[model samples]
Target chain A: MSGAPATIKDIARLLGISVSTVSRALKDHPDISADTKEKVNETARRLNYRPNALALGLKSSKSNTIGVIIPEIVHFFFSSVISGIEDAAYETGYNVMVCQTNEMYERETMVAKALLDHRVDGVLVSVAKTSTKFDHLTLLQDNGIPLVFFDRVCAFIETDAVVVDDYKGAYMASEHLISVGCRNIVHLSAPENLLIGKLRKVGYCRALEDNNLQVDPYNIYLCDTSEKVEEKIGRILDRHPRPDGFFAVNDSTAIAVIQHIKKAGLKVPEDIAVVGFGDGPVATICSPTLTTIEQNGYEIGYEAMRFLLDRINKGITAIVARKKVFAPVLVKRESTARRFENR
Target chain B: MSGAPATIKDIARLLGISVSTVSRALKDHPDISADTKEKVNETARRLNYRPNALALGLKSSKSNTIGVIIPEIVHFFFSSVISGIEDAAYETGYNVMVCQTNEMYERETMVAKALLDHRVDGVLVSVAKTSTKFDHLTLLQDNGIPLVFFDRVCAFIETDAVVVDDYKGAYMASEHLISVGCRNIVHLSAPENLLIGKLRKVGYCRALEDNNLQVDPYNIYLCDTSEKVEEKIGRILDRHPRPDGFFAVNDSTAIAVIQHIKKAGLKVPEDIAVVGFGDGPVATICSPTLTTIEQNGYEIGYEAMRFLLDRINKGITAIVARKKVFAPVLVKRESTARRFENR
Candidate 1:
């Protein structure tokens, strides 16, 4: 219970060995005999000896750690990405420092500063909903710190980025609805200020145009929360000429739409087909299941870390800023069938 | 593009100022004029100067980072908990260093050692599934580093722990099922080697005893995966007299059980009532809207972090090794209903 720390000298004294011998043993020096090293290590363990990392950091200037900043960890997409990043970093003997922005711009900026303060060699970031600026991110790059962006990214920042083909995913969802004999399809949109959201909206519009369907701006409803989504869907359902199909931005909101539809005594696919983006767990667990676009969150996370590590090792002089985009795959489930079929 | 690091002297030379004045302005010294401080600050910003954190760490001996070890980030429960932890930590200017064990005991031990090597002030741990031994955790505590356990914990370690009232939650779930007039009840359990599993089972037994119902060993099944659970539930249902009620340890498994029961041409509440633990999003979105025991995962995370920070601030001199148990609430939904009224 003593506040005093145990050092190499303490272990050496306890084991009746010289300080140099104890140090060599602790460092696995070849000159030290295996038996003597083992005895010294055992004694060190017994005495609860922990080498000071601060002193080591001062000597080596490398902590072997990376910082990761994301909007929210609870989201299915980000968590999958984090899992992949952790796997890659673990293999390389690197630890990840994670921070959540909670979709706040101020929090995102704070996390960047905190990561810098912690001396992380590099950072992996997914910008928040309100993050329209890039001064903090640019500053990190300017200071020779490697930065990588995944999912939601800032277009102005010149850094390695990993993004899913949001445009293509939205286009496919809209086109699929058209292929399934739906003309009036409502696109549930998120905030329009971000790059990903704008890209997805464009994709949805292109799909409608290509299919010779009228692109009614009224059909594009901007909703963020589940309650708003339910209210919007309710209003949509009560219209004079209701939309035959719906394409939602994310799975959680898509599931909410399905729930509201069910509560109104209407069956999915029979009354209105729904396609959701992000094949999250909520999609599968929902009744009738959700037909959605499946992006490889884990691959994005893994590649982002790999790219950041490469940047860190090669230095800023060796490589130019680059962006990597992952394509989304369509997962056919019961939600968008020709007719309603209860499992 | 220069490999050489820019210093205060270089900044002062570029701005035509003294090095002492530059340093003073950077530190916001009172002697520095406002106009001169602004100029120095602007020049430093234009050059993207960052003070070395390693030097600071050496002087302070505190890394200002907390190491976090979780079983998996992909799981909804752990991810939600992490969000809470991140929210709390960021408010206190603490950054989180994260590692995933993937439920391997060896990986858990390695992460612990690595965190220690990186000089983290403390560790927040959720033990892995294969963690049967406490020797690795003991190594951390013996080194004078504080440790806090949340969710999946090691019972042998006498330290601060944050846990939900698993026993009470399970008891409530069982009692709810019995009240819905389910005479034949089965408990879908996780691995019984862990404290959580054992505590939940005890609660199930207590509920049965309180209701004057005999506990049948055959009614309890251990399931670790969806496939294993489906197979086990299939065998139980194939029996002469099938169980009319089910209580699952977690929501994912509960959803799987419900899905399997539906495949067998049975309806929830009408044929069998189901109650699941962990009132996750899946519980609400699932068909029939799962009746579940709700534990505030975010609150548990927030409180756990507060407890750890308190301990970290007080250091080893604090004698109170506190354990806080959060109560779980039962969410009544469509899955459990009056047996006599249903078809």
Candidate 2:
């Protein structure tokens, strides 16, 4: 990579002094005289010297870098998390090496191996939807690398993690619709591989059961890669008795449901109220302004970095694993405020 | 960071062979027989041995990593660009270290220095809004590290770059509004530090000249750290003869203008209309969906990576710096489709 940058040795050679004296002078050490320090500083500036990171890494066995792996960076949720990671990394004098899985397990395994090969001091990860088998993830801890998970995390991984209360968020979404007089509420979700999806589905059912309503399997539609999500939602809407409410796993799905409801000549909230999760910018941009569960991605990222740094600095074996969960807040908006004030 | 991943010495120890033989066998040298290769390969897998990246870097002077610096990663346009970079980097066996400047000149300088310190093979950058100084960027080329600029590019830098024709995009947006019978058009922009903003302003002026309309200085509002954009827009709307149409440098600014217009009790299209640049999902999601100049972000990113890779592989000195420009197409949507059929 251009034969390495100018180093202390280059400055020492230019100034006709020992490398140790040059380093000490650059640090303004008391042992180094003022005249020699000034001379060394001038020479260093002329040579455009920068302390070699690799050499420092070799000396301390620390790169001062934390590897971060996310499902996808293009997604608003993940990018917000990255913003948080960057903010914390900057304050701690650390750099972040980001890897995106794009929701693929195989890519996650490959990226994890590559991160290890880079000799990152620690790794912070949000597992992919397909990350059912986690030998690739546990391999970090196996090799004594500090590991922390955030958001799309695995409970069985035995590591520190930061998560939102997905179950509570889902319950509030469904209960909000019920309070607004929607009898049949439909939930569109994915499989158990992504724990959030399953937790949300469970919470939706629990809300129905708690409200003395039937939790029908027919009301719960799986919207994985099974094709034709719109068609599936359409058929569900055309059932013997139509669903009066919908709660989607995320904003994009909720936006689509709102579009479908409009196509069926139904007014939002008046006929069918919809709520989404993550409460990203899409929630406000959509017509009727989707009422949604807000997961603070920035806070999750900050906590994940804090936890991983703790594990990295304090020996991984010495620290107890933690499961840090943030409570999801229901942001009331036009979409679900039919019988309530629409603010 | 954990004494590096396994090295050739580890594999050789497990196989009871000389380090030279292990290395030669791994490389499939003719001197090393096939039987030894089989044994070495098996042992390498068993020990989970990977060639130490630093060791290889020293041998070949290639880190196989490209540093990527952007203004912000949380934004949709930049994230899409990152997705493309990831796809290309994955295909070419190169890792990416991403840095966000957050539109701060000091951060950009700091990040550039850090990336240089990392000894990255090359750099791919999208300049920040405040990146008026080019010395921080040109230092890479001065040190023989290949540099590629994408999207927010600087023309003075002698490097390969891929960019959307912002001037043309702005022209199309203004001309469309003129065609729709708008007499006075306002341009919302930032300072000249971000070249796209300046180019868009120039194009907006050129469009007015072409349409035989006077380009009024009162219509151009500069939004920087010193002022509140909302109050400025409100004042412009309160002008005796208010602007009939607005063209914003980006979608977020356009959305804000629309909100301000609605608050002023002006009907969109009939009273005022707006168009934005960068046709992202926000365009459709916003009320009176934004008609915008659609820059192919994926293509810009893909081409930037491809060009940078070519420069990286073919030696930056040997190749002439080239500028590749993409034409922006006007995506007709509700916002500027007064005479045209809206989707």
Candidate 3:
């Protein structure tokens, strides 16, 4: 070794192993076998290599900062994810720069370039609802910036992603409503442009088909806001056949549906059982509470950041894209607490 | 005019005024009088000066990015503030980098250094609950980075601050409770180290004294969290001559107090009126919707960022610090909808 100090490259050279393998072993990466890790450790001890050498190698280009892009910061789900990302980053001596797109594609594109200019080491993104083009996202990857998608992913980019099992969550919600003796169900869906939107609708249809119930396309409405509920819900209620249960895309929409149902002199669960996705604080605070799917935002964010950091450290850009899906859980509340005998 | 282009200095020289004054007038800054603004605009038109020249002048060191540091992201108030900051920044072609301290002083200091390293043009901050020392914040000023304090201000730092009128808000809340026939009102306050904590306590006491009621120190409890409420509130309720009302530091604490009061077989407003600060979503969602003070988080954030951007543009570091106080509004709801008979 030179007078200065031994590096990871020196350890790899002494052990006759690849530099990447040595780096992983030093970090005790699960992919690296224990035997290799032990060997790397022994060689590192013999060489008297300092662990900070690994960081020193990337210090020149590394800003020790990560960028996070989300639709909105005031949102409960996204904010929880940010909290998770910040906590995870803090543990490894990294800072986070967060940007909100306000669900605008142009703004998302604008902020992406800003993050690039800031020279962040890696990026964790949940694409905006209005984002259709992937050029801006691809621009980040093209510039050799590591990218990880969480909650929402761009199909055009082949990168690591963390997504909730929206289909399964929606399916479970529909099934629970059916089990509670709901014969006619409605889905307050998201925009068709989003993958999760289509998946959730498909799941609702699948649940109805499996239960031998009619999967009426007319029952599914692209009503995800209070204004939409006000505009379209009255007509749906006044129709010859009314929905007995509602599965909303989010808790806010579900709460809105409940309010509308009550305004029409109806009781939840008795007249219309309701289930929402993303069991945020409002779920418990809403009247009769809200039975919803827990998206586990914090876990998703932490895992996504962890994955992005790993990939950035490994410095492998051409590797196959990785995907991690988190399971969604159904939380029982008064909104869906109804029982009925088998028909 | 030179062959290249006209600049603010040229216009200032023509008008025989300082460059700073000319720049402020061009932007229609409130400090600049209307006469100065018209003169500056008239001179700029005659000189054929491009507004982009102003941006070009600061382009060398300006990252077009601002830093925002708050205690937490999952919090309703802070997240709303972030939304406001992002929107304001976005409107002006600026990006925001947000950091959360989790209320830890060490983390706040570390993130402050990180923002410094990123060379942000300016920073807007809400001091962490655990932060007492002002060295980390002063470091930003030392590095020529303009700083603006919002919501939570550091007493030692000499800079612009945007704070809600916490004392006046608290006074209004206690007075409202008194009007609703809550004679023996207990105050659930924040930590004494916080300025808001002291101000709110004083406000509550003054309200009591003004109403000809005794300002009992024993009735003031240093409780701000649900865990603290669980631990201390039961004892407070069980005390002889049990308190008939509760004034809490924030909405969450007030909600928790309401829950405990209900568990103790007391009816809201009718038996015990409760008032909280920060009229968040939970205030309306809670049963007998809470009557509280609206802190106007978005306005505060927007004003703070705008102020910081102004400071950054003018490039003035040594001056008298400015303070902006937002008046808190009392939002009446079912929680405090009681009428009192003549005492």
Candidate 4:
């Protein structure tokens, strides 16, 4: 009456009928009398009533909503992936519900359970850095919910996943530094347990060996955060015959390395060349700009969601888990643009 | 039985009772016999069945979930706000569902409707930049849902809102530039339709007036996005008696301004000084590091969620609208550190 769309309750009240009776009559239920159905239809027409999609879902068993769980929403790469997922969902006429675990195992478990309880049509996830167990994720599958993993996947889970070619990206990064005439290189790596960490390390070693340089285990450090970079970089820079090149796991880490290098009175490219993975916005914002691997996070997200929806539409049946691996592109910038005359 | 937690459906299947009967028996329904209730309780204990919070919430007419609607998810400020909201919700035994509108009016209206259909216990909002009308938000209120706004708020809404003191922050920014000996300063402003844009422009004008400098209408340009900044900055830079300082609506725009200025051969804080709002991650990563206002996005989100929970607990009594405004702090960085000796 106030210009807001009429609901079933309003239609029932107008006709002095029970809400359920109005609902039944509107649906043309066999239990309802013909006279009641006609009256309900006429009254519904008069009120311009439209059923709520979610309320309709209660009967149809479809929410038309998808859930996404990520390690951190504030991280640029993850956020970009979410943006991609949102774009795909919006186009498909679906709403998205996002939850972040803040990179905690306990929070990841809790949010996973919460998503299950909400009965979303499907779920997209990127496993947390600290998560070593998968019982919570297994439960979602046990309950027959479709799940897709992106960026960070549960290795043992049989499901669709989308990932970037971390190994190739790392190889390109290490090789780029070598091409710029750096003999000894240092790698700021992720936790060894993660697939990304292992692959990147292997790639870095392979590139060194191809160039006839021995892989020095002492040059690699388990440092991904800024604080770790600041604390450990000084020691590395002070070592006799200091490392001439630095390759980091991500953009922020690379930027931090540059800042510390500059603070220690060393010039980037001139003294210590640097390269990073994940071409986030900070890559362009940083001084001397960062040359890094371009991870197509948005495309990964869009493809993951598409895979999930395909499974959702196909219904509960055994299907082999699928994976789509996107190739990484090396974006050259000032940070590693040494020897411009050489190549 | 296989290490996964047993659900109510499992209990019903084991006892060969209807799902509804098992649910009612477990809840100690009056119509259920003592024997049935005892059987249900023992089975639940033996199976280590934990009640799903959302399932229980359905029975209690509460979802135990709060909805958040933002303009974008990848944005650093908005993501920080969301992180604050999530932190508060987790501590209070609540789940959060987030949606982003990508600054589109239609998407905002659709998502608002979807949140309503999902029956979230309450909602927290930061209206879209393109949202000129308030019908979608008003509909949420009409449906008796508790609404709280943060950062961006609708003027006509009778609800709690948390915002930063944009006017005062702008005043400080302009005054700081003047103190650094900037005679002709230009502002890269937001659209006038937004409250932040209007207040910030007024504050800039007042600062000029207070310093006995005439406010040049030509210096105030309606430019906020990076694309707009790129398209319009060249002409401004080419103007005779060029602007000696720049104040932008946000960090990204300020960073873009600085890039263009440097490209034009003007040194930061030497030939031109710059200030930005919102001390996001990019502010620190950018060259010359941005001098900007700390908007306290996390605190604003936490407080907005607190106010929303308060209203939700009060159960829909006609209450007066409340607002909390946070003071802004200016962070000094190399971008505007011209008078290092004097200060």
| Chain A TM per prediction | 0.89, 0.95, 0.82, 0.89
Q: Per-residue lDDT for B156-211 in model 4, tens only?
A: 77788899998999999999999888989999898777788888999999999999
Q: How good is the docking of model 3, as DockQ?
A: 0.19
lDDT of 3 by residue, B83-180 (tens): 88888998897867788899999989988877765567899999888888977787777667889999888887788999999899999999999998
Query: Which stretches of model 4 miss by more than 4 angstroms?
Result: A1-9, A16-57, A316-318, A340-343, B1-9, B16-59, B340-343
Best by DockQ: 1
lDDT of 1 by residue, B1-343 (tens): 4333356878899988898999899999999999999999998877766665656665665677788899999988899888888888888878888889999999999899887776677888999888898777777776667889998878888889899999999999999998888878999887776788888999999999999999999888887566778678878888768899999999888888888889899999789999998898888888878999998878888888988888789884485778989988999998897554322
lDDT of 2 by residue, A214-243 (tens): 998988877742134576876887887889
Winner on lDDT between 2 and 3 is 3
Give the Å error, residue A340, model 4.
Answer: 7.1
Tell me the spans in candidate 2 whose CA falls farther than 4 Å from its real position: A1-4, A28-31, A224-228, A340-343, B1-4, B224-228, B340-343
Residue A157, candidate 4: Cα error in Å is: 0.7
| Candidate 4 per-residue lDDT over residues A176-251, each given as its tens digit | 9999988889999998667788889989999999989999999899998898998898899999898889999998
Question: How high is each candidate's TM-score?
Answer: 0.92, 0.95, 0.82, 0.91
Candidate 1 Cα deviation (angstroms), residue A179? 0.8
Model 1 stretches astray by more than 4 angstroms: A1-51, A339-343, B1-51, B340-343
lDDT of 2 by residue, B1-343 (tens): 3334577988888778899999999888999888999999988876677665655664566777788889888888898888888878877887888888898889988888887777778898988887778888877776678999998888788888888899999999999999888888888876776778789999999999998999999888885321345768768888879888988888878877777777788877778889888888878887888989897776777788898889888987878888999988999888876764232
